[model samples]
Target: MLRGLIASGRLLANRATTQPARLSRNLVTAAGPTSRCSLPHTHHHHPVAAVPALARGMKVRSSVKTMCDGCAVVKRKGRVYVICSKNAKHKQRQG
Candidate 1:
């Protein structure tokens, strides 16, 4: 019984030491900032440039809509409309 316990304890100690080394090696190989922001490969690409704002000349006004407080007059669908700055749909599109 004593010999079996001693052997098992030694085996457990060996397993514990080996596990940490293996885990550390795996962690070292796997851990880092991944290429999350990489753009997909594509053909027929145009040079990237910042687009000037469509509503650059528009004036801001208090919102009359139910969704938000601040609003801006912008042309959409060949007609001008009041777009609320604090709208939930606008927040999601921005993100």
Candidate 2:
């Protein structure tokens, strides 16, 4: 039983070392800018009010079409506006 346990432990240690090298290589290639699999940079500018709503446990709605129960509303510069939902004056700004 002791021999079996020692063999298993050695096998596990060898396997762990080999796996990390393979994973690290893949990560380096994928993260490189020249790699075809690399994702495009996306700049998302969130409204100023999103910070307070996130702290208060409100989930950000994905679409403007969804009706919010007054939770996602924000007041900025004397104007009350819905952060996620589309208003009558302006189209919904896609993040």
Candidate 3:
């Protein structure tokens, strides 16, 4: 039902208003439209932030933590986390 609503655009009603909150180009700071601004060639555009090239290598475990090479089971914020500093690939969490 939730997927159907999202696909039908009903769940996206709030997204239309939230897009400006993460806008890459700021209208208030950027130069006005070319037709209205006197300096049409001098547009004040802000550089977009570069995205980090990282990978999502987390696993969702059905049980709490693992006994991997260096995994440690820990409880935090009412949730369970399995962190492995030596083998970061074996990191996972469950709640």
Scored by lDDT, the top model is: 3
| Ranking of models by TM-score | 3, 1, 2
* C-alpha lDDT of candidate 3 relative to the true structure: 0.71
Q: Over 4 Å off in model 3, which ranges?
A: 1-57
Which segments of model 2 are wrong by more than 4 Å?
33-95
Query: Which ranges of candidate 1 are over 4 A from the true structure?
Result: 32-95
- Top-TM-score candidate index: 3
Give Cα distance to truth, residue 69, candidate 2, Å: 65
lDDT of 1 by residue, 25-87 (tens): 666666644533344677787898998866433333343233455655555565545666665
**Alpha-carbon RMSD to native, per candidate:** 15.9, 17.1, 14.9
Per-candidate clashes come to: 0, 0, 0
Model 3, position 48, has a per-residue lDDT of 94
**Alpha carbon lDDT of residue 80, candidate 3?**
83
Residue 92's lDDT within candidate 1 is: 16
> Candidate 3's residue-wise lDDT over 1-95, tens digit each?
98897786964777876777656345534655443433457767899989997875768777865767688888889778888878767778783
Give lDDT per model, in order: 0.57, 0.57, 0.71
Candidates 1 and 3: which is better by TM-score?
A: 3
TM-score of each: 0.31, 0.31, 0.38
Worst 10 residues of 1 by lDDT: 86-95
